[model samples]
Target: MEKEFYIDLIYKSFSGDLSEEEQNQLENWLSESEANKKEADVLEKTWQLSANFSKDFEINLDAEFAQLQDRIDLDEKGNVQEAIVKTMPTIRKKSWWKPLSVAAAVLLLAAAVFIFNQNPATAEMLAMETLEGEMKEVALADGSKVWLNENSKLTYPDAMNGEERRVTLTGEAFFDITKNPSKPFIIDTRDAEVKVLGTSFEVRAIDDEIRTEVVVKTGRVSLGKKNDLKPIELTANQKGIYNSKTGKKLNYEVKNLNSISWQNNMLEFNDLPLEKVLEDVENHFGIKVILENQDLLKCKYGSLFPDAKEAEVLKGISSVFKMKLVESGERTYRLKGGDCQNTSE
Candidate 1:
């Protein structure tokens, strides 16, 4: 394939534009062999470097194009005619300022490169971590707070320098963002993007499903489709759950104000189904609980329990459901098969 074609494909993939087939093809091209993977890695790294580098420097497109043209000619092995034809589009957009602007931009980019390479520890520090069975808290340079759930990871700049504060995450996290009207805070995940000026929200992205559960604990936040368009604006006391794969969003009034109490060592549930409750417990405590009875899994319950020992919590759940709890192993707990006689009030 032509270099320009590959470049366009890369750009489209980054912008989330390629169709499923095209995406598969691109992925195959990227991982087909060792050579392809190396090329893709180089391209991806270059794109990342260009995206994050400080934009103070001006760029001279003409000079860069000229150098590229020379390299292409040499690599084409005397196919100068085909090379010129391939580069015609770029050649047509010539401007006198292009060369000088590119020179200035290159200088600025070089300085940024130097700074980025100078500090290895800072680069690692910018990455997010989620310990097993523990939530990791991060205090951003801008005074924003982020709580990353177990088995989660986030990446951000050590410090924000310019017009936008951007971060990438995998798994789940809760954000208590600092207000900066001039600079919008953006969280990018595999499923969707959450943007906020100042607000508190929870985002969960896992298993091809992206759920941005936003509750404006303080200010307003806007949830939007990542790499696509503007999201619906959510004010205080409003919540939105977005599913990226389906492109469906469910919006509702924020209920159960104690939703985030789990972060403070409290587990409060209001009309939550047993399955969801179990999911939360497993996530919070990092233990696996298996329900032997499928019917009980669908039952809904409401309760408040202190974030105490796992055994205590399990015992409380068993009492509420009138079910027997059997500890199978160190990390395994099973709710024995049973049915509740009288529902707890």
Candidate 2:
């Protein structure tokens, strides 16, 4: 078969515009060899994804056509170089049809690339959001998973179409990525970006926060600004912090065992101080915990509340420290008591 005929067949197959005879001919050709079948399968799947995305996202055809025209102009410029060489009678005499054949192939290949790229469409962007006091779980198209925290939003593509599986984050989320060595998963945030092959990690990029953070639970992650040349890399049980204002890699930490605790609906205090425990509680419940008596911050508490309510956690902490828990304002609570080493409970 001629190369142009095969290229046309592939293009027709991609668009699902192939006639019955053409489809049968293509199917027979594919079934002829394993390699051919694989190529056809890849093309079909990629085209399907693009076709679906194109339906949802209206492409700027005028702009896209303009870009294609520019590329074609560049290709024509290359043809001009071939024209200069054509002036040589000896080269022309050596092969009368060779130059024409070469030019045809070049133009055909360029046209194929431009047409394939333009019609399949760009990646289809999708998003997930959670309200205050709510959390959501998302299953990505690539078999990866995400746990979106309260008041957070995550934007991902319906299909990961390029060299990387990229998603944008606006608040906090825990990602459990599926392994795809050829295509690394990337989390894009306002302050920083996180890249990994197939890893589970937590990313926090709250709008008002002074810093954006990445806590890796498994595998390895590269964390820094999206365009940073040398982003800080982290492995399991490691964390990377970035200063939002300066866009600097602030620091790295080695422990983040409870990074995904909130996803499990569990609050764990492992020999944590009263001050830190309150901070965690505040973050988890979107509430403020204040110490009316400054000395109450000195207490070290250790406990676990699995699937516990907000009131239960407050009451538990108050009873153990012998502190008075009082509501001061909406979504705010105060701990009034003495400084005591309350590691007993």
Candidate 3:
């Protein structure tokens, strides 16, 4: 088999593009010899590095690729292979990126030369990012489930073999962590960190963000600054916030249960002030709500909307408040002709 055939197949395999026969062929190739298996591993590792990498700058790609080309060259004529693998690196594109060119194949092969040469601690972990308006669910090696909100990024090891199951996060994600008291689950958000033995929670700490928050859905979470010995413990139905600018650590009872509504699109308000309720609605549907009468803010509302559309939810709220719903503009609304009342349901 031509070396490029295996390279293309390997890329397709990682991308889930391989048909049943192609998958079997790959398995057969790997089983043929340990050399084939080792080469495949290295290329795959290189593929992961390009996804998103910022680490050890020791091994220069040009120098390293030159060395690898000399060794891995199978065909007596190695000039073509040398030129293709010399292009710029592109490991990751989208979540499930496909093969690009022979150049990318060579890049992956070359990167693996140094990437796996380093110790496990120095290896660049895999990264996943969701674009805006896209949500993704990921399962970790430790059996934990992560529901990543749109515009969020998660960096995790290929396997959870350390004393602690650790991951780094940017943006927001709801975690249904697998319980493992021995190996606590830790999420590092640059300035802040959340340690958990086994619990479910939602964390929001954007890049260069001020407020690093964790809302506990189940179990307990220890929230604190990165590398800080002293941390605030949060229980279920609790929220912890560490403000980097103010250097303040705050713990509060979780009032809004639908804080993870992005995962399920469920809106739940428990006797919340009209002003606060509208804020959540606006955030979910990206629709701005205006109260024609400030008195409406005095009213408290309680309801549960299960997978309801924006229009349906707004109509329900209007009926409950005895108000008229007016569409002011695209993705904007006005609640007028309403009287303040204890609208609890």
Worst 10-residue lDDT window, candidate 1: 105-114
Score residue 2 of candidate 1 by CA lDDT. Answer: 62
Better of 2 and 3 by TM-score: 3
lDDT over C-alpha atoms for residue 149 of model 2: 77
Top model by lDDT, which number? 3
Total residue pair clashes for candidate 2? 0
TM-score of each: 0.48, 0.51, 0.59
Model 3, TM vs. native: 0.59
User: What are the RMSDs of all candidates, in order?
Assistant: 25.4, 31.1, 26.6
Tens-digit per-residue lDDT, 1-345, candidate 3: 776798789988878789988889888888999999999999888998889967766865644654443343323224433533663153223221222111100000001001111114844487788999998999888788888888877788777776777887777777777777788777776667778744666666555344566666555667777677878876655556665544566565545766667766888786788889898999888889998878888688878897958998899888887899999998889999778666453
Task: Answer with 1 or 3, whichever has the higher TM-score.
Answer: 3
Q: Per-model C-alpha lDDT, please?
A: 0.61, 0.64, 0.68
Cα lDDT tens digits for candidate 1, 1-345: 665666578878777788888778777677757877777788789878888776576766644554454344345534544654787686446342132221100000000000121223334337877877678998887898888877777677777765777777766677776767788777766555667655456655553333444554445556766555757765544455555434655444432434454555667565577888888788667799998887887677777675646778788777777778988998999998666543543
Ranking by TM-score: 3, 2, 1
lDDT of 3 at 44: 88
Model 2 residue 292 distance off true place after TM-score fit, in angstroms: 6.4
Best by TM-score: 3
Tell me model 1's lDDT, rounded to 2 decimals: 0.61
